[model samples]
Target: AKVVASPIELCQFNGISRRDKTAQQKPMIEVISSTDFQVLSCINQIKQNMFLQFPERRLIQYDCGKLQTLDVLLAQLKREKHRCLIFTQMTKMLDILELFLNYHGYTYVRLDGTTQIVQRQMLMERFNSDEKIFVFILSTRAGGIGVNLTGADTVIFYDSDWNPTMDAQAQDRCHRIGQTKDVHIYRLISKNTVEENILKKANQKRLLGDLTIDGGSFDVNYFKKNNIRDLFDQSSTLEDIVRERNEYQQKLDTSRTTIAVAATKTTTTTTITNSSNPDSNLTLTQYEEALAAVEDETDRRAADELNKEVRNE
Candidate 1:
């Protein structure tokens, strides 16, 4: 039986682009498991859908929608002298935010994947300690990588992420322990499109997480189950399925081996020590082992779908 893959590339985009490539010429499309996607992918797709829907306003400014909302919120926050964290999925979008902040003459700092290792800590410290800096523009993932910005009481998720946990982690950059004032989170969603779909998926995932944590039952995907036989003819024998599965397994094994070797060579050891000392004094070695165990579990879970497909075969 053939499994219909969830195509990563946006579909129903049959219009022609004004270039060598036609709109019909789609990007490399393939179904990736839920683990392969992050919130940023949905953000990019929604941005594409917006421009696709509104072809006339190609030169329109970026801040017309969320920026207006941002202006009103920041104005009030400035009056209260409350610092804020602004996060976007796309770095180019971060550039737009930089422009908006510059237009308003708001002193701000920035952090992204490109920021140098030495400069990141310095930048975070300045944003936290400096009174002049009123805003911090950050890439969603980069902001939460290593630095802590608890000085900001308000967080603006400049865009939506498909994975709800990603946004949640970014929001906590300010709302975590040692935060004094009440924290506020604002997620800017486009009017309608894949973004709204992403929001629905995110909410469902959030509900699932809550249910699991609370000892309740939940379904990951809300779709109805169907039999594998529906995808193939009745004449297709078990041997044919086994051969197809074996060939795919061999290819996957090769890919996995290559990836594992590359990862092993590039992986670096980082130090982690629990300083809270809240009664349990877990040693650095033990902490590292526990972290490794979690990492292993995450890797296995990411590959669980492949394992399940094999078992079905």
Candidate 2:
């Protein structure tokens, strides 16, 4: 007869040790000049440590980085007979990484937003039990929360989201209560890149920004007082062009909409001969249309104001 596991039994089986050193270890900075080199060196070091600690077995981590670094890291991990769980932010990146890893002769599994709910559970089960498969590349946003990656001892942030809470949640995928070993987190931030500046800004905000904002208003004064100009300066290569084009396009569209709405409003108000009986003459659709026109006009004016603000910046 087949056996079914109970929730209480499963909880006991997956419980983490109170004595886990990884829980107590202070987070350290492992800086390197290049993201690629940092990832390579870190993978090698993790494999060496794994060998010393568990020579008869292998362990891996979730990596979210470029295809090149991931390829090199996977090769080294496989050479040491270790398993890996890789994560990426986008499905496009995941597809590219999957192709590259497969091309390089690695046995791996993947889970992304496209994966069905039922299929995700099956994949997770296979990853936990399979001995031959060495890596699981998942989308961080899709697989970062409510997953049991206790099979992994290390977690790598190949890239980071602007929000630090997301990063913390992603890291917790392996650092949870069931983890037995020291959970080593390796965050790869490219020097002088946007990711580094984002990290600095996120650090200044107590390492979490998503929780601090409410109802569209945030503590902008805190960021201003902190003088975080350097954080916003690391704009991407195409940032200026994209920003300029988008701003210009938004202004033009707003202007056209505003003009059309104003014309309609003027025509409606003129057609309404008696102001005292405006409500009687106006249909619900007409009232809604007028309100929409006013709203669109207000939006256009706001956009113009924002354009001035951007110009000053």
Candidate 3:
């Protein structure tokens, strides 16, 4: 009979229990009597089956205790020559992991909220083409959408987001239409941490309400209580702010586009009216265009001034 090791036992085997005398480390292993090992075994078998059936993609959740276990998994993936994407809710945590990976001589690409649009496109291209870059560290909020990352067949959620939908969105980035191989998702949830509790609450809330709020009438107190600032706040977790901000920004962009289109139409109508009705009183379109031109100039000046104020802030 094949012996299946417990998570704690696996951690110990990975050298997670070895400690430095000078630095204090949290107990790397925790006993979970309630954990269903039989179910896990069955699930593992199912995963293997799905891997065969789908042969193109698979999703699996690994609820393990120690980070070292993740290191071990990554090592196995490296040996198998698997390209992977890792999603994190915190940019700070993403940075820390990037640094750790770099120190360990792992070649990876990191993309977060601070990454510019052009830079993001460049990184995506590199990730797709460069076999040397086996890992892509992504901030869930910034790098989650609007990019095709079919090159990677595996996605690891280093931590759970409040909303499972957010996690799904991140995973779909890899498992989308273009992906040819079986994609596997590994969700690492620390056994009894706030991370687990947060997931439960978020999932419950999702069942009650929508996964995210629509464009208008958000609660200001919620932001205050959470210490969230405009989706890009360092203090707020990437999942909490970025999704909402991205949706809002999309709405704003659409509104701006509509306004610009309307303005152009008004200008064209005015030009046509001026040519046709030479001696008649100026048409409404002509008046509207002149008004719009003045408004546009005023808005541009106001935006520049507002930008200066924001820079000072």
Give candidate 1's total backbone clashes.
Answer: 1
Report the number of the highest-TM-score candidate: 1
What candidate 3 gets wrong by more than 4 Å, as runs, is: 1-65, 206-313
In candidate 2, how many Å is residue 237 off?
A: 17
What are the candidates' C-alpha RMSDs?
Answer: 27.9, 28.7, 23.5
Model 2 accuracy (lDDT, Cα): 0.57
Can you write out model 2's per-residue Cα lDDT over 1-313, one digit (the tens) per residue?
A: 9999886666557684434434544232223336668788999999999777644311122233444465566667677666666655556666666656655667778876556668878887887778687777776666633578777666666667544655676777777776677766766666556666666655544422322221223222233312344555665333443465456556656755665567665543212123333334434345334434653343334334433544576
Clashes of each: 1, 2, 5
Q: Which 10 consecutive positions of candidate 1 have the poorest summed lDDT?
A: 222-231
Q: What would the per-residue lDDT of candidate 3 be over residues 1-313, giving only the tens digit for each residue?
A: 9999987777678766435421333232222433567678889999999776644311211223445666787889999999999988667677667655765667999887667679989999999889899899986656534678988999998887654666776888888787889998887765445565455444443443332322323221121212111223333343643465556556656755665566655543211112332344543345334434653343334334433544576
Give residue 209's error in model 3 in angstroms.
6.1
Query: What lDDT score is found at residue 236 in candidate 1?
Result: 38
Q: Roughly what TM-score does model 3 have, to 2 decimal places?
A: 0.46
